[model samples]
Target chain A: MKNRIVILGVLLALGFSAQAQKYFTRDARVQFNSDTPVEKIEAVNKSGTSVLDTQTGRMDWKVLIKNFLFEKALMQEHFNENYMESTKYPNATFKGSITNLQDVNFAKDGTYKVTAKGAMTIHGVEQEITVPGTLTVGGGAVKVKADFVVKPADYKIDIPGVVRDNIAKEIAVTIDASLKPMGK
Target chain B: MLKKIVLFLAVAGVIGAGIGYYMFNKKVPSMASEKSEVTIEAAQLYQEFEADEAAASAKYVGKIVAVSGTVLEASALEDGTPKVLLDTGSDFGVSCEFDPNTKHAKTTFTPGEKLTLKGECAGINLDVQLARCVVVQ
Candidate 1:
């Protein structure tokens, strides 16, 4: 009787895990480029965090403002202080899900076009956004790639008139991350 | 006298613009040359952040902090950026990303090895993150 109960417990645990597979990564590379006729600025943050639930299609992402590194130190300083206000609003986050979760099978190995709708909060302002991206599932890992444009004014990221020409109206952002199965 | 006054003002304006341009284009200073403002144990730093993140961020974030601990993991990103995790007696620890701008003397770290590193505190995300870290003895 004891042996039967132990076996049942093991089976139950396996079934639970197989049904609700989760993917996670702490080292997501998030890059953004702003190009204008007068100047071009780019920065990359390597410590972006993301979590995905395959069963529910729920996902969450967060990146620290202070982590973004720019080639020029002065630009970084101005971005954190004058624009992003790292001391006050330290993080940018996305909370949402893949709208068409059933379209692509997570068990399959292929590149699937997916649309994610979420609320992105930046500089302490929240905005609803829909993002289109490619999700490649293979070799027990998933690679997520997305390209999107963000308007600073929409998020209340004020750009002073003095440097208006130096910054782009729409900033191009790229997200590339490989998420591994939870618990190795 | 009017001609001389205008010429003097022009020279001063040109000098001011030159200095502004130089400062604007200046690169981030090397971490090796920077001094750590706060020196603490890795476990303590993590504990403080876990206790009160806002308080810890106000005290340590953006400051060059030196933390000493046993290395839990040493790894590199896809772009070859080195990162080290210090053990904090919990699930998470203090994470330090080696300075890409400053050449490091030793990048490879074995688990359980005691080390001290200093970098600007970039705030906590699961682990207390330190950016542009350099080995400090």
Candidate 2:
């Protein structure tokens, strides 16, 4: 009887602790730019969702590909129909953990450098990447910012030779998201 | 023969100039300028997306839609763009992001006021999000 009671108590404590460790946000902003000598293309998607567990340093992020908005309608159509093939692959997701979690003080208000290593899947292709970012904790909120470069060839996206000179070989991506407590 | 060649070159130059002007100076289309593919209520829209996300995406993704709902929340984005979220009677709702240059002068939406908007559907995440939305009524 004593062992049974101890097990129940431990399970209850684990549930509460697990709930406290999660931080999430629904409106994370993700932007990307492809700049070459001939053309400059840009898009922004603000419907990103992300969740982070402070206890385990596990993070997950998802953004819908069709949500990216371009200035020109033609570019937007081309991005969805030709480049990303949103009908086939509607979302891009990242699953990884913070490698430098020990340096981050979740209870304090400060900025810490973080390294995230994980697989980022875009256009049905997955690539393992490690990128450095910054985490800012203030006012009971957490802000994350990161910049990385991706090659279209890595994602099986072929650029036609006709527009090869207009598009860059490496596309620069930027992410900025502010996260608040979950279930608030 | 030389005169004919010069005439042909002049005609080609005129056509090239016209094409260049249209390509570089085309204006971005406004949300009100296009027809919506679907018209749905806020609750129903969210329900469809939440029920079967893949089917909902196939039906509404990359299409213009008109949604009518009550305003649950309104806020300015990081870049001062206005965003209005419609109530769906659940945790998830419809989020409408307006264009930066859209006119919202002297406009204030009290919570629970019914409003209609049109925009391009961008699939769903936590919400059925729409971009470049314009107020229809």
Task: Judging by DockQ against the true structure, name the best candidate.
Answer: 1
Clashing pairs counted in every model: 0, 0
Residue A36 in model 2: lDDT: 91
Per-residue lDDT, model 1, residue B123, is: 96
- How would you encode candidate 2's per-residue C-alpha lDDT over B1-137 as one tens digit per residue? 99999999999999999987787546457776778889999999999999999999888887899999999988766876777899999987899888653565524567788989888888887889898788886
Give the per-residue lDDT of model 2 (tens digit) for A32-93.
99999889999998878999988888899999888888887677777888888988998999
Residue pairs with backbone atoms closer than 3 Å in model 1 (clashes): none
Docking class of 1: medium
State the displacement of the C-alpha of residue A144, model 2, in Å, after optimal TM-score superposition. 0.6
- Candidate 1 residue lDDT tens string, B1-137: 99999999999999999999989999888899999999999999999999999999999999999999999989988899899999999988898988879988787889999999999999998889998899998
Fraction of native Cα contacts reproduced by each candidate: 0.61, 0.53
Best by TM-score: 1
**Model 1 segments beyond 4 Å from truth?**
A1-20, B1-8
Q: Score the docking of each candidate (DockQ).
A: 0.68, 0.51
Interface root-mean-square deviation (Å) of every model: 0.8, 2.2
